[model samples]
Target: MRPAVFFDRDGVLNEDDGYAFEPSKIRWIKGAPEAVRAVNQSGYLAFVVTNQSGIARGFYGEHQVHALHEWMAAQLADVGARIDEFAYCPHHPEGTVTEYRQTCSCRKPQPGMINELSKRHSVDIHRSIMIGDKQSDLEAASAAGVTGHMFRGPDLKEFVAPLLKQLPRIR
Candidate 1:
């Protein structure tokens, strides 16, 4: 099984522009692309797991989120980096959209997304790591049996480079 790196999209990969669902609003965090490339070279699968409560809140639709992600992927491709897959939860308990108003397991601090991804990708949870800028992110990672790192930085590559060195390399 391959170990993976789970990234919290908003605060970790890009600036959280409050319900940002447009490519124009995306401002990637410093070294975000390089950090991802490092993971790619380290033989770790890179995945994005995020919560998009804005969908439930009616601020945007799933199409917008998907389009934004596609745009983001193309941006990363420009730097020779690629995210294997993207997973996001649109459910919110208190929401304007009736279809997505109920609480679901896929949300952050819930571990549902991580658990599902681990199962589907055949991930070695023990060696997997999660990096996020929130307590909830760590909580979710713990629940899923993966190590979690808190990031407070202006440069992602600086924070990630050393951490990548410690993980067991996969063929």
Candidate 2:
């Protein structure tokens, strides 16, 4: 089983440009690519887990979100950091869009996505890590039985290096 660096896309990978659904508006957080590459080099898979309630709110569609994610993946590939998987929750309990309005476990703070990924990828939940800029990220990791890191402030790249060096050396 492989360990993974589960990331939250909006604040950790890119600036939260409020319901960012377009590639043209994507803004990579400084050092985000390098941080992802670090995870790759450490032999850990990199995955993205996000919540896009905007779709449920009728601001966009699932296809649009996927397109932006595809562009994000392309950008990461350019930096030699490939995402092993990407998961998102498009449901909102009170969503404006009828089709997307529903309770879902895949949303952050529920661990649904992580649990599914754990089964599919055979991931070492304890050794795995989750990085995000929100409390839900931390809660999800905890619920999934993995360590979590909260990215604070503007530049997170500066912090990744030191943290990477300190990750309990895996045998």
Candidate 3:
């Protein structure tokens, strides 16, 4: 089975300012594109899992989230890197938007998103890894039976190369 690499959107991939939904607000982290390309070159499926509480907090809508992701995808594509898919949770318990005001398993610290992606892509979860900046991200990866890396990064490509070396080579 193919293994996957999951990334947390906010701190790991881009600079986050709380409710950042605007494409203009995004600031790509150093070597973000190269890190993605490294994963792509490693023959691993790359995916994004994010928590967009901004949607529930009434700061933005799903359309804005989609737009931002599309923008992110275009940026990655320009560098010959691409995300296989994206999964985000729009729910928050004290959300201002009633439609999204409920606890959900897809949120970080839960394995729902990773599990779903693994199932859909036929991933070998045991060999996969999750790169994130928060404990919640690591927790979700653990629950999903994948290893997790905490990225306190100034350069993501440098941080990712050694980790990529650990994956079992694809047949």
Candidate 4:
């Protein structure tokens, strides 16, 4: 099974602006590409898991989200980094949009996203890690049985290098 490096889209990969959707609005954080590339070079699948409550609030549609992802991918590719997959939870328990206002397992703190990926991709949960700026991300990682890294600044390398060293070498 392959090890994975799961990142939270809003804060870890790009600048967090509440519920982001527009490609033009996306901003890459410092060390973002380098961190992603490191994971790739380490033979880890870099996946993005995001909580987009804006969709639930009727701020954007799925098409917009997909477009944003395509744009993000292009941007990452430019830096010699690529995201393997992107997963998101668009539902909001108290969403104003009726269709989106439902409690779902895919939401963070539930581990549904990681669980789905683990099953479908044959990922080793113990060898994976989740990086994000929110506590929810850590909670989800813990629930999924993966190491969690909380990101508070722009430099991800500083946060990740030591942790990466601690993990058993893959090669």
- Whose lDDT is higher: candidate 1's or candidate 2's? 1
Q: Using Cα atoms with residue i matched to residue i, what is each candidate's TM-score against the true structure? A: 0.98, 0.95, 0.98, 0.95
Summarize candidate 3's per-residue lDDT along 1-171 as a digit string, tens digits: 799999999998998678889998899989998999989988999999999999999999999999999999999999999999989999999999999999999999999999999999999999899999999999999999999999998898999999988778877
Pitting candidate 2 against candidate 4, the one with the higher TM-score is: 4
Task: Give the worst 10-residue stretch by lDDT in candidate 4.
Answer: 162-171
lDDT values, one for every candidate: 0.94, 0.87, 0.93, 0.87
Clashes of 3: 0
- Candidate 2 residue 32 Cα shift, in angstroms, is 0.6
User: Once superposed on the true structure, which residue ranges of model 3 sit more than 4 Å away at CA?
Assistant: none
lDDT of 2 by residue, 1-171 (tens): 888889999989999879999888888888898888888888888899999999999999999988888888888889898889889999999999998899989988889988898889999897888888999999999999988999984666686777777766555
lDDT of 1 by residue, 31-107 (tens): 99999999999999999999999999999999998999999999999999999889999999998999999988899
In model 1, which regions exceed 4 Å deviation? none
* TM accuracy, model 4: 0.95
For model 1, give the 10-residue run with minimal summed lDDT: 16-25
Candidate 2: deviation at residue 108, Å?
1.0
Predict model 4's lDDT versus the native: 0.87
The reply for model 2, stretches above 4 Å from the true place, is 169-171
